[model samples]
Target: MFKPIKSLAFATLGLAIAAPVMAEEVNLYSYRQPELLKPLTDAFEAETGIDVNVAYLSKGMVERLTAEGKRSPADLVLTVDISRLSAVVEAGLTQPVQSDVLTANVPAAYHDPDGQWWGLTTRARVVYASKDRVKPGEVTTYEDLADPKWKGRICTRSGTHAYNVALTAAVIHHLGEDGAKQWLEGVKANLARKPQGNDRAQVKAIWAGECDIAIGNTYYMGKMLEDPEQKAWADSVNIVFPVFEGGGAHVNISGVALTKSAPNKENALKLMEFLTSPKAQQIYAEANHEYPIAPGSEPGELVKSWGSFTADDVNLMELAKLRPAALRIIEEVDFDG
Candidate 1:
């Protein structure tokens, strides 16, 4: 029988290793940086007395897990981006996790139907426009970026990057294949410079007056403001949550999954449930400056200051299915060129 998660009396921890593993422990292979996860790992250890050993991987998580096979020690996998989570699932690296606590705490839209992965938080892919130049109503939707009225005024990373690909895929879902392709070509023709660099770089380009607007994830605004050198870049733009013509803003998630090879399945499930609990939700929201997956959990002050927008409810699995098509469209448009 499944159990309901009853209490969330977690004390904020300084989050260093609580103690050495003695009785029980769970191993984690995470694509998320250690700094972002330290607080959650600390709290889980405090609440359940289970030691969490996390291996932070910058890339190649699937390859590493596959190469290790069933001999692997990874009990849980944590990563940012739905596509990465989907990649792990496609590679047969994770297993289905059916838990009462999980279904109760996470909305069905944010978790896998088969329970292969559960989204922990969502980051909106929004437009950052020059506060001095682009007026409040100048740009309103993701589709608006393609208008010839804004030609030579947009900055972005390469179209093939996971973030853009996912956004492009959503457009494909709403529009037909031909519509998605035209939007890609339209936005590509409006580029300020050949797509180069990451989201933060796009904001810097906006700050430098290289372009009047740029497309980037919402959380990057919080990150830039924290860096003394990038504060000016952060100050130069107004965050705009752009919607699709008939839908809400495009959003993506950082998710967790149970590895097929998990040795400590019960303990791993405990940690996963704890992560979606209100207590752990706040810690992750505050740390990453993202929207919590758990209802009633609020985002950090800085993130709140940016205002909010409705998120599209298109199934993430649908977006995952469109990744290859999105990439094909990107290639067809010669977007980076």
Candidate 2:
């Protein structure tokens, strides 16, 4: 009788057609620029039927997340610098991830002990020297930057910036407070300017012959080279991978964490696992010129051509914990002056 009606099946079919299935969606609060993450997200979306919605925040991400509280839509957080990652975790804005995939892909050194955040890629803070002025093997270590011989020649951004602070924290972690203070003072004496500009500006300063050497992240070399206007700035310097006196080159990371209020926890975890995979790491490295955190993941040819060096094994958590002390040291050293 129902089949004879020809209506029951049609009604059911119409109802099914009226309601469409939605793709799984995960929201992101990222300090990372949208362009920087699009390729990865696009790849992720293609592989998994999940949708990535990114709300890029240049600053105040923590404040916004805290304001949103439990009702927040943020499923994940991506940021550069370990200090930012540690701050998010310490602020209770993140949740610990207990995924085997994440644990397996990321080295213990690259992730939080509490599993709150994990590094995806790293960038070394290295020296950029004028090809005409600086000689090979002339500056081999971070300590060399402080030597009086380079006085009035070295350029850098404000010591208070997260990048420099992290490095300062590392110095404190390895050399002790007093030792770090001395090192900060020594490097401060070597500055060419009042520590005014960004890393790119430091390179530009070298190209302008305003300084013989500059300190910046290794990744900037690639970024500058890719920009038509900045290519000349990049071409002016020799990328040097400098290490700590007895340790390796100081490196920082671009990392990720799970939001505490993730509505789509499963999808978020999936995204987290995917990001640390070798494939994603390679994509990120090639896109951003960062060194992949996944071991044995090779960087792009451009990055490879920059040469390689030993990276310091000092736990980044230690550096994050020491950042406040490091900032104080920067102020005490009057490094900005």
Candidate 3:
């Protein structure tokens, strides 16, 4: 269920503008598409008997929250990527939540040190290699993507895209700014064409022989396999987890946070805890094709079949902090030009 922005009542001078409804409900402002969250939200609603109302925002989530201030009815904000999560926290739109369940389910590296946001699931930034054109062991490290040998065989989305920027930020963490800049330049010089299209489009290019390999999130392979029109694109490639030299694979997360202006705090907390529960985590893995973060929780069978790699040890908050620098380096290299 989704609530229209206009349907919410504002509180003034600590007084409600309209009488409150009796039924328990939690309002969510989410950047994640609603369909991806339906199963998890439905399960939470069913088990707790709490109605879930979602307002999907494509952009300006921070701006809207800032404008609403104390009048905002949103109890929680759900989004993907650490950068967006950090932005909301930086804006002070979210409040820190301390819970034994959240702390235990999410590894320290995947959540905020101060508990501003909690990671629910993670997805790796991996390579999509053509099964026919590329051999296994040919591409093993993030550094190898810049090799001269594969100069004309690579494809990617825009350098400034959040996914790529996060990957660049991870590179910055591993090798200072100077090293990361050079690597970006190397990768730019290796592009088969101007960085254009989404991650799945890169896979389509592989099927069409436009390129041999491309960088994309691991879950996209699952999505592609599910689409009849895109199944061939998925079947044409192998999922490859590349490591940052001396580090493991780079990954990002889908996370949730409690808003500062929560109208139904207790119910919102219940939903947050439910999101990290083993049952909800399993639904997230099976329904959305993401890797669950809960203790003893495992990826759906399809995800498990793709194989696994140790996640890079650097905390995601560090990557969020470096995003600006990463964008600067990407611009300096004229990666899309």
lDDT agreement with native, every candidate? 0.87, 0.85, 0.89
Question: What's the best-to-worst order under TM-score?
Answer: 3, 1, 2
Per residue, candidate 2 scores C-alpha lDDT tens digits across 116-186 of: 99999999999999999999999998888889999899999999999999999988877999999999889
Model 2 gets an lDDT of: 0.85
> By lDDT, is 1 or 3 better?
3
What is the TM-score of each predicted model, taking all chains together? 0.93, 0.92, 0.94
Please state the error at residue 211 of candidate 1 in Å: 0.3
Residues 1-337, model 1: lDDT tens digits: 0011221212211221223233477777788876678888889989898878777788888888887777676789999888999999999999999999999889988999999999899999999999999999898998898899889999999999999999999999988789999999999889999999999999999999899999999999999999999999999999999999999999999999999888778899999999999899999999989999788898988899999899999889889999999999999989998
Global lDDT of model 1: 0.87
Best by lDDT: 3
TM-score of 2: 0.92
Greater-TM-score candidate between 1 and 3:
3
Worst 10 residues of 3 by lDDT: 10-19
Better of 1 and 2 by lDDT: 1
Off by over 4 Å in 1: 1-23
Candidate 3 ranges beyond 4 A from true positions: 1-23
